[model samples]
Target: MKILLATDAYSVIVNGVITSIKNLRRELISMGHDVKILTLSSNRHSYIDYDSNVVYLGSYDISKIYPDARFSLSYTNPLIDSILTWKPDIIHTQSEFTTFSIARKIANKLDIPIIHTYHTLYEEYTHYFSPSERIGKYLAKKFTKRIYHKSTCMVVPTLKTYKVLKKYGIDENIYIVPTGLSMDKFSIKYPKEELELLKEELNLPLKSKILISVGRIGKEKNIEELINYLTKMKFKNIHLLIVGDGPYKNTLANLIKDYNLNNKITFTGLIPNDELNIYYQMADLFVSASTSETQGLTYIESLANGTPILCRDDECLEQTVINNYNGFRYNSFDEFSEKLKLILNNNGLYKNFVENAVISVNENFSSTTFANKILEIYEKYIK
Candidate 1:
């Protein structure tokens, strides 16, 4: 089977959507299926990289909202002819913007089914462009409903997302497919010397208990809550390592300075994807206060590396984190502080959580399993 994945976010933009799409493509190809990517050209000039199975459409940078994303101006891109010639059996879209509109056009032209995965909840991202929250949510809902109605089927990463769409009155057939990760990648052993070198390089305290969070440092992420909680903690050797960069970096840096907690928090602007697993492995625990995640891939990645998670309680994490079994979830700052102290101070409990973390990821979130589940969805519309 031939599959085409169309997304506005890809290549240079390193986000969960791109990660999920790449993993799905790799697994599908390994299973003897052909996959091609249709995305905006990262280069200033548009070109097609046939060897890489990618078609880059001409686009203008959209750095105001997303630093590395671009918006294609041409509704009828010149490369559409070449994509039509490839004759994909199905089109799976990962975004709701330019690439998605193109997906609909191509699907209508080729008379092929288009499957859409709602990755980001735009309502949570209103701060980027909308003048007011009310207007932003109303516009986001209208846009989501319009694009989703065109797809043959809708794929949501979690039941939480499904509920959101249903509440918006979208009566489409929605399938819950959690994004999968290459668990083996995280399990690979990094040399003890390399780990030590990384710690020294990042200036991470050797004796400190590392509490790391990986994702965009955005307002919607609610990272300020994590920083605030860190200040109130009674633990002395605890250090917060925020991994990733975003528009909210300056705001967070200012907040950190105002509280005079610079020593307690370290912001490692943006780490390369290849080296990210090492950070997760080096950490004693992974933590996230963000409530906007669809599936929280970083949580799964941390678990795969045998690091226990302590995250804000959200419905999306219900299937991933088993409280007390693998990790604990908290509803408020007080609850988070209590859980953090209990998990960090108790050596026996920490050991059990670490052991259960690995087991949970292997059994439920393997990339192979994710691809197989997606294949089931593809078959439903492929005819």
Candidate 2:
């Protein structure tokens, strides 16, 4: 089967979506299928790999506009031309706004089946638009409903996300095909020796208890709140490691300075995918406070690397981390800090959580299982 994947936000820098598509392409190709990607190109193009034939449909100039809206245009003509030339058996689009809309149109014209993957809730981008969350959500949902209705099937990363979309009257045949971690590449590489070397390289103390947060540094990520909470807690021997960069990096750096946490927090801007497994293995614990994630890919990656996760008690986190089994969730920053302190203080509970985390993630969300399920879904519709 020849498959073409359309994405509104496609780049190696964006982490989850790129990694998911890359892994999916590898697996599909292994099973004797041809796969290609169609996506927008940002200015830097720093992160995109050159192996695959990725059709660049649009360009986003970061200096002129906000990041969220820059990739929102429905740049359909080039993609349509590509579709007519490629003539893929299946067109699987990863975003609703422009990529999915274009894919739906092309699929209809070519009489090919279309599959849409809802990577993130469009409502989450509301903070980028205006101050009014109510109006933002309304507009986002309205646009989403209009676009998604045209898809033959919609793929969701989690059941929780699926339920939310269903509530918004997105009644398409939704498939829960999650983003997965490469278990072979990442595992309980709790190499104390490697960690010691990494600590030295990163200029952190040997005794520092690393609390790693891996994701976008954006307003919707609630990173400022996490930084504020950390300041309030003021835990001893704790070091914060932020492993991604975005529009909010400068602001976050200022917040770290203002709070007098210069020694406590370090921003390791945009770690490479190959290096991420090591970082995951080196960290004492993984923490995510982002409520906007449709599926927390970092959490699964952390679990695969045998690191315990501490996340907010949200639908997405609850579904992935069995509370107290693989990881724990907190309702408030106070609770989260308390839990953090407890885990940092106690080695026994920490060890148990790490053990459980490896088992839980390997048993359920491994790439093999993810690929097989996705292949099954593709086979169902391709014919």
Candidate 3:
């Protein structure tokens, strides 16, 4: 099988979409298939990596809309012509923006089915456009409905996202395919000596229980909600380590200062993809209050690392958080506090949750399973 993955997000962007694509590409290639990527250039200069099977279209910076956002004119290029010559068996789109437009053009020219994956719920990002969530969602629904109507089918990471698209009145086939993790990469263990060195470098208290949250620092992420709850809890021996960097970093730092909880929270900005497991391994638990995630890849990543998660209650986590089985979800600050205490204080329960966390991810979210499910979708449209 020859698959062309079209997206604006790629290697440079460290988010769930790119992570999912990387894992998908790896598994597909491992399964004896050819895969190529079409994405925007970091700057306004077209480039192609024939060795890696990727094309980076010339684009202009659109960071005013979102970080590292690049936009292309969707015009014909020699690189695009090469892709057309290759005659991909399937065009799987991971973004709905300029890249989707570009991919749709190829799909039209080559007469191949284009499959789109709903990675982010843009309806939750009203803060970026305006203060009106209702208006934002309304506009988002109309735009999404317009964009996705052209694709043969839509693939979503969770039923929550599937329901959202249905609410948008998109009648196209929507497949609920949970994003898969390359579980082995996350399961790596860092020796205690190296873990101690990491703690020392970050100035994290060596003896304190670590609660980590990994994602972009953005308003939509609802990170402040986590900080607010942490402020109220004031657990003496628990420290929050926020991993990753984004536009909202300064605001979060100031919030921590205003609450005088500087000692309780730490930020290690933009850790490389390969280094993620070390932090997860060092943490006793994973925590997040973000309701914006479609699949919450970090939840599975943490669980795969044998670290249980405590997250805000959302339909997206229906399968990720199994309450007392792997981790617990909270509907309110009181619930969050109570659950945090429960996980940290009970050694037996903590051990069981850790064990179950690995079991759940292995059973449901491995890269092989994700790739096979996706391959099934591709085969349905390829002919």
Candidate 4:
């Protein structure tokens, strides 16, 4: 089948949604399917990368409204006429805003079905719009309903997001399809010398036990809560490595100084996606206090690299991070402190978790399986 995956976020931007799309596209191509992408160009000029099967529509920066966002001046892209000639079997939308409207327009022109994946829960990002939580959420719901109801079916990464859409009175068919990581990307064995050089460059002590968190540095991620909980713990040689950059970095940097956690924490601003696996491999544990994910690709990516997780309790992590299994979940700082000790203090248990972490990703989160599930949905919708 010829499938067209459309999104505003693509190769230039780094985040969970793009990660999921890259893996899906790679797997689908390997499975002998024709797949193409439609995304925004970084500048106000549109073009196509025939080699990568991507259509770049020109857009201007809209970061003031949302982080790393860009929107085209007009809904119609001049280059879109060429894509229409190709006539894809179906359109799969990875973003809800600009790309979504374009996808709907294309679907209408081609008379093909559109399947939208709900990658974000806008309710958690209320602060970007207004301080009033109730009003923000009300706006978020209205916006979500207006956007998603047009699609033939809606895809959510977890039941938590599914419940959110249902609560918003969205009547579209919703499927709980957890985003899959490309496991082979994390199975790499980097040279010891390279790792040592990275350690030196990042000012990481070779002997310290590393706790890494990988994602955008946004307020919604609640990274401050992790910093707060870590300060409360009376642990030894445990360093926190925050491995991404975003709007919240300045705020978090100030908070770190307030608590005097300079040596205890390190921020490696935006590591390249290809090199990200080594950070996970080098870490003793993957830690997160954020409950604001549709299904965090980092958690699965960490597990795929044989690193166990220590995260806050949420419906999203209910099945991925089982308590005392592959990882541990905490409801409070006290609970997080105890679990931190349990994982970091016990050598034998940590090894067991490392083993289970690899197994958990392989048994449940295979990218090929994810692609096949998506194909099934496309077949059902494609007339």
lDDT of 1 by residue, 1-383 (tens): 99999988666333678789988998999999989998887655677888878888888888886655688876656678888888999999998888998989899989999999999888988877698999999988998898788889899999999999998998568998989998767758677788778878889888899999897778988999998888877568998999998888999999999999888889988876767889988899999888899998888888988899999999999989989999999999889988998998999999999999999998999899899999999998886
Winner of 1 and 3 under TM-score: 3
- Whose TM-score is higher: candidate 1's or candidate 2's? 1
lDDT of 2 by residue, 95-138 (tens): 65556666777787789888877787768878776579999899
lDDT of 3: 0.89
Candidate 1 clash figure, as a count: 0
Taken over the whole model, the C-alpha lDDT of each candidate is 0.87, 0.78, 0.89, 0.88
Residue by residue across 1-383, what tens digits does model 4's lDDT show? 89999999797344889989999999999989999999998998888899999988889999998888899855656678877898999999999888888989999999999999988898999989877999999999988887777889988889899899889887567887888877777767777787777788889999988999998999988999999888887566889999999999999999999999999999989877877888888888999989898888889889988899999999998889988989999999889888888898899999999999999989888888898899889999999
Worst 10 residues of 4 by lDDT: 73-82
Sorted on TM-score, best first, the list reads 3, 4, 1, 2
**Residue 357 deviation, candidate 2, in Å?**
1.4
Off by over 4 Å in 3: none
Work out how many backbone clashes candidate 2 has: 0
Q: What TM-score does each of the candidates earn?
A: 0.96, 0.91, 0.97, 0.97
**For residues 166-255, could you state the per-residue lDDT of candidate 3 as single tens digits?**
887875688889889887787567899998999999999999999998988888788899889887887889999999988899999999
lDDT-based ranking: 3, 4, 1, 2
Angstrom error of the Cα, residue 105, model 4: value is 1.0
